[model samples]
Target: MLSAGPTPKVPLDSWEFVITTETGAEYRWSWSELMALPQETPRVDIHCVTRWSKLGTTWQGVSLDTLLDGIDTDAAYVLAHSYGGYTTNLPLDDLRGGRAWVAHTFEGGDLPAEHGGPARLLVPHLYFWKSAKWVRGLRLLSADQPGFWETAGYHDYGDPWREQRYQGD
Candidate 1:
């Protein structure tokens, strides 16, 4: 688990976890509420832009589809925000159809803060940076808005199989 910032501290109190949409609707769920949702344990292969790959890593989290279910929107992208002020953007499609989750567990245990505990956006199909550790919320967008890494010239869409690691790669 690598990041550009220190691990953020999770609040001990009950706070709302929100997902905002481009249409101005917000769905806020408590941590317990999220845990109550159907959980999935996906064995995914994670590739890092830095050249490290972890295969078949187990993660437990609520599927993005479940969270977004019945929420009406025409958005095509998502900006995932983390507690420590980190953010990443991805095509909303990459997060649907069992492709992503807001995971709170790893390897059948609580996910450590350094590993995006409490909850983190997990889009295993992309480079690990797109996972956005310490994730807190998501903001839907109609356009392809760039987040931290993309603003820094990293590939807007990070596909490991295509070896899309940098601006010109």
Candidate 2:
């Protein structure tokens, strides 16, 4: 089990995942409600920034693009905030076009909390760290602001193929 911080105990019954933008826009998705939304099962190979890779894993959830449907935004980046103060940044392009998901299930079962149960961002193209665990919200920004790990010297845009693990790598 790899963890960058303590696992947050998210209350499944009372939690609501949210997506927001700078211009006073917000969408609240109750756990059950979001799960009822259109879901996709994508086979993703996750590469961790810590030098490990899990290949061809399956996940089921709502695609980021689908969640953003009908929402107009000119922002170029997003700060994905989680229930436990964890945050990661992704370019607007990264979260669109089926590149990411707000996943709630893994391997044909409800996602275990240890693996970010209720909802987590799944961005397969980038290092797993960019797939923020226990994700609760996404705040759009016009500027590319660094997230938690990025601010702590990890690469802002973690591309696994390029092995962009740390700042200045």
Candidate 3:
């Protein structure tokens, strides 16, 4: 697994996932609460910007649609925040309609910390970097805000199929 920095170990008991709207309103879910939500096993092919591809990987987790249900917001963008201060941005639409999930299990087993154990954002359609590891929350924004990689010259919309890796790609 590729990481921008060292892996972080987050305890499950204190783990929490939050979604904050542009209006400052916050929605939260503890580990137990998250686990109780409806879960789905998605088998997808993931591609990395570095030219590596992993096909037919299975993951179990709550769908972003399920987690975002009942939320009221007009934001058009989202910034995913992770436990180790890692962040990534995506169009809000990309996260809905079963396009994404907060994955916690891989291949029928608990996800290891090095692989974003407790939870990670899974956006298989895009390059792997768009899937923020150790995801802690999502911040809704009215305007696009570059995250860790985006700010450093990575493409704002990292579509692997189109080879959108660097800013000019």
Candidate 4:
């Protein structure tokens, strides 16, 4: 797990998202697009691979449970589209388990962009990389897939409680 350091603050009004693939493929997303997604409020603990664990982060944004609604995702895994085309993939079930969220606000305030502002996936159970920043969209896959650091041998689940950081798990 790597720490990008204390996240810089960016107002939600200034936050922007561009969903892209490893090959520079992209789809621009507007704040309104996110606002349109069904919203939910949840209590979460964020574990950064950098080792900063922020407990009880109250967030507001689209719930993975709702964002994926009606989408026929046959893939067994999911890849999160991110800035710089940096990406990470995880088990689809983990995403759909009703614990994931596209969080925009933290502690009732807008999340800073450095913290993956506008919106970022909050997978509290996994190491931070599994929780990609500047999240744009989700890519479904049929097998265990790796992304960015995962290709560099990072763990798949990244569960902090169990210390799933590298591939030896």
lDDT, each prediction = 0.88, 0.89, 0.95, 0.73
RMSD (CA, Å), each prediction: 1.1, 1.0, 0.6, 4.0
Residue-by-residue lDDT tens digits, candidate 3, 1-169: 8999999999999999999999999999999999999999999999999899999999999999998899999999999999999999999999998989999999999999999988999999999999999999999999999999999999999999899999999
TM-score for each of the candidates: 0.96, 0.96, 0.99, 0.80
Q: On a 0 to 100 scale, what is the lDDT of residue 102 in model 1?
A: 89
Ordering by lDDT: 3, 2, 1, 4
Candidate 1 lDDT tens digits, 1-169? 6888888879636545688999899998988788789989998998999999998899999999999998888999999988989889899999999999988899999888888887888898999999988888889999988889989999989999999888787
Q: Please report, as a residue range, the 10-residue window in candidate 4 with the lowest summed lDDT.
A: 18-27
Indicate the residue-level lDDT of 70 in model 4. Answer: 57
Runs in model 2 lying further than 4 Å from the true structure: none
What lDDT, from 0 to 1, does candidate 4 have?
0.73
TM-score for candidate 3, residues paired by index: 0.99
> Arrange candidates by TM-score, highest first: which order?
3, 1, 2, 4
Worst 10 residues of 1 by lDDT: 9-18
Model 3's alpha-carbon lDDT is 0.95
Better of 2 and 4 by lDDT: 2
Give candidate 3 misplaced runs (Cα > 4 Å).
none
Using TM-score as the measure, the top candidate is 3
